[model samples]
Target chain A: MNREHDREIVRYRAPTRINHWIVAISFVLAALSGLALFHPALFPLASLFGGGPWTRILHPFIGVVMVVAFVLLAARMWRDNRIDARDRAWLRNVGDVIHNREENLPEVGRFNGGQKLLFWVLVTCVLVLLLSGLVIWRAYFSQWFPIGAIRLSAVAHALFGLILVCSIIVHIYAAIWVKGSLRAMTEGKVSYGWAWRHHRAWFREVVSARRRAD
Target chain B: MALQSLDIVRRSATTTPAPQARGAHSGQVAKLIDVTKCIGCKACQVACMEWNDLRDEVGHCSGHFDNPPDLGGQSWTIMKFAEHEHADGSLEWLIRKDGCMHCADPGCLKACPSPGAIVQYANGIVDFHEENCIGCGYCVTGCPFDVPRISKHDRKAYKCTLCSDRVAVGQEPACVKTCPTGAIVFGSKEDMHEHAAERIEDLKSRGYANAGLYDPAGVGGTHVMYVLHHADQPELYSGLPKNPVISPFVSLWKGAAKPLGLLAIAATAFAGFLHYIGIGPNRTDEHDEREAEREAQRLRAEEHP
Candidate 1:
């Protein structure tokens, strides 16, 4: 509990961690069910969720849940995820960052350039998916639009869905590849070394704030 | 291949070959509608409703004789009426029966993601098997003719089947059988094309020079072909798409896009896996931890000592 002895600092609060996991779980469900419906080769996956009908019925609902959870998470994390001049400098040294030469990079804040870029990409893909989903959603809004509009929306939905799934794959891989990152989400804390080495500017700000509080 | 079930030649979303035994005995059937002979009496529509047992809500007139206004889940077929004036200023009432074309390269079957939801029989009848339908309504988007309608009650797609059930028993479609003037004819595609040629000759003899058959090859020709008087201006008959083909959007979404999307997703995962193998985890060891604690201690000491 004591940061001085534990050598750990709070990286995510309990609410933030819970929100993130909800989004993650929903994304997995939605993606799998969607892919199952998207192609015939993956049709066997429909058995995992009752059958084809159930998978079709559940995917959109799961997507809606994910969108709501992601929106909440994004609202809370937007300030920290914003890209700045220092983040661009960090990106410029991405080769070093990828090779673990963190010392060569600028002082990154709460998020590095790669993470910030992915955040915006996720935002864009999610918004497109939502709009296109409404248009092709046969149960409700599709009849209101013309066939041409529906066809375009169907294509857009598939393309954006592909982008989102790919982006999330990278997101998941980065979280796992960075040794302390999973613990930050799961345990709501990261080691002082993690903060200092990866996000020194944000660490300094946190320390100053702690000093002021004391 | 039995008489009751028309053997399926193609299936939607199917990877393997379809049943092939029913080919030698019967040629592809077609229903030809002679628009010039159609009196717009809607007798065929009435026969369709009775045979299909469809009672679409008796919709009020919408300023035109075309009852029900447009096709719906219940209404499988409707007669579209268009009043046109020749350059000579004489009015001609063009009546066309609007229903499924049952394209040889059916877009509904191609865009369908569910196996056996839409099927094309050897007799060239593109049919909707509602039991297999998941109600995704992809067929509605894929239909070049905009014929399929998803029902609100059961959420299954409904369209004219070209009377596959009747054809199986060696009978013409109810509408064709009931046509008072023989405006609708059901027979082998070859016979119908020959009949349409005779009709076109007769129409030309009557000074209707532009008469031709509307068997659009863009959709590989349709099972339900039309003999239009103004074949040059087929669009004159209720916006009959001048040159209808499956929407390119549907084609890309169902065609190259599928494999490309799968490849992109797989490539992303592969890249991440390769990165991990090449670079390993970016970890902070005990030395880094000690250095970080020492710096924090120095900072606190400077502030509060």
Candidate 2:
């Protein structure tokens, strides 16, 4: 029988875990508010955020919060996301992914190719949204900026919104498509078998800890 | 002599054979509407609703015959009326028909996660397949024009099919058919462009100097073009984007992240391959194991010595 004292090593500290949840929750809020502002028919969805005017008022603020939270998360995990030479070779054989032949593919450590790409894409999108949103924000910055700048910001905001939506769609699909991925975010843990199969390097680290304790 | 030579070079450059029209290869019939001529009767809206068999019960039917405030499950097309007072004290009305622009670089097509749910038909029309849609609403967010609408009942995204079934059989869209003012023209984009230019010139000669065609070279140029009479601003009219662009941030993200992601995967795989070939750096765990073995051997040697 497993003893209470014989737990595995911590993969993420409590602060790191909490920061992740903040970004995740804020992202959902921003996405929902964004969709409401995107169309008139969807304007009714603003009621979810207290109504149309409130939704509009709160959208940029929510975006700001999301950006701040994501920036913190990014700083903490930036090193893990850096691309290495081995990653290039893994990409060349990405076709194996389409066939569910990852067994023959490389064993990744903490984060895989898909996760790293998502991390960086989210970073770029959030940055663009925040900057452009500031430039075009009528309630706040329109008085301070030139007309041309405001116009350009409006265009940029729309464009970034489109890109972020697309990327998030792909991100969500990948999470759902891969069976055990959502559990990592939701429960903050994955099953032993799932970790061993998908992230074998990390799994080995955990196993070695067990042996040392024994 | 220098100015003359420059003029000659410019003339030659301008006269060079223009590249064959891009949309021509797609076999899609493009539609361009001259909004300057549209009287905003909304006959096209009625015709679209009837043709598509959309109902009035879905808050789509605006009283007084406007029958739809915006694009929704029951409405494929809408006519927005923008009225402004001219400097001369007379009121001018600019009417625009709102629907899918059927852009060459369709964001909806790019954004859809479910394959085959949203597709660009060979004819250049963006088509939707209900069977393949997971109803995730990605297309709703992807569209720059805010064209697609999702139904709460089934969660499926819907939008103008650009009358694909009718166009396939070589017929005009229902709205174009019902337009009495010849404002909504249905023809090749090239022909529509020429017609719109002539109409704009005619309106200008007749004293509407503000009259011009609205076709910005963005979204790779929308197939639907508009000619507006009000010279003030196009944004006052509904369904007109003040500024539209494929966000550079998206381009940068796609450019940088996609390659880096592939690289990360490749590196991980190469590490695995190295392990297989026995040339890799000792696996981290294996290195620890080797270190432990070395310490044990040293302890034995010390005892023997």
TM-score of each: 0.95, 0.52
lDDT per residue as tens, model 1, A1-214: 6656467778888999999999999999989988887878877788888887788778888989999999999998888788888888888888997788888998888888999999999999999998998899888788799899999999999999999999999999988888999989998888888888888777766655552210
Worst 10 residues of 2 chain B by lDDT: B4-13
The per-prediction CA RMSD against the true structure, in angstroms, equals: 2.3, 15.3
DockQ of each: 0.71, 0.04
Output the lDDT of residue B299, model 1.
72
Give the per-residue lDDT of model 2 (tens digit) for B1-305: 42111111111001132232233353446777877667788888788888888765556444543446767767778877767676899786766788888777776665553434665654557767665564544455456677877665555678888787787667888888888988888877777778888988999899877878776667877767678765347786764885565445433332343345435444655544544354322122434334434543454466556
User: How well does candidate 1 score on lDDT at residue A103?
Assistant: 85
iRMSD per model? 1.3, 14.4
lDDT of 1 by residue, B53-168 (tens): 99898878799989988888899999999999989999999999999999999999988988888999888899999888988899999999988998888888999978778887
Candidate 1 structure, TM-score to reference? 0.95
Off by over 4 Å in 2: A1-214, B1-28, B56-67, B85-90, B249-260, B275-305
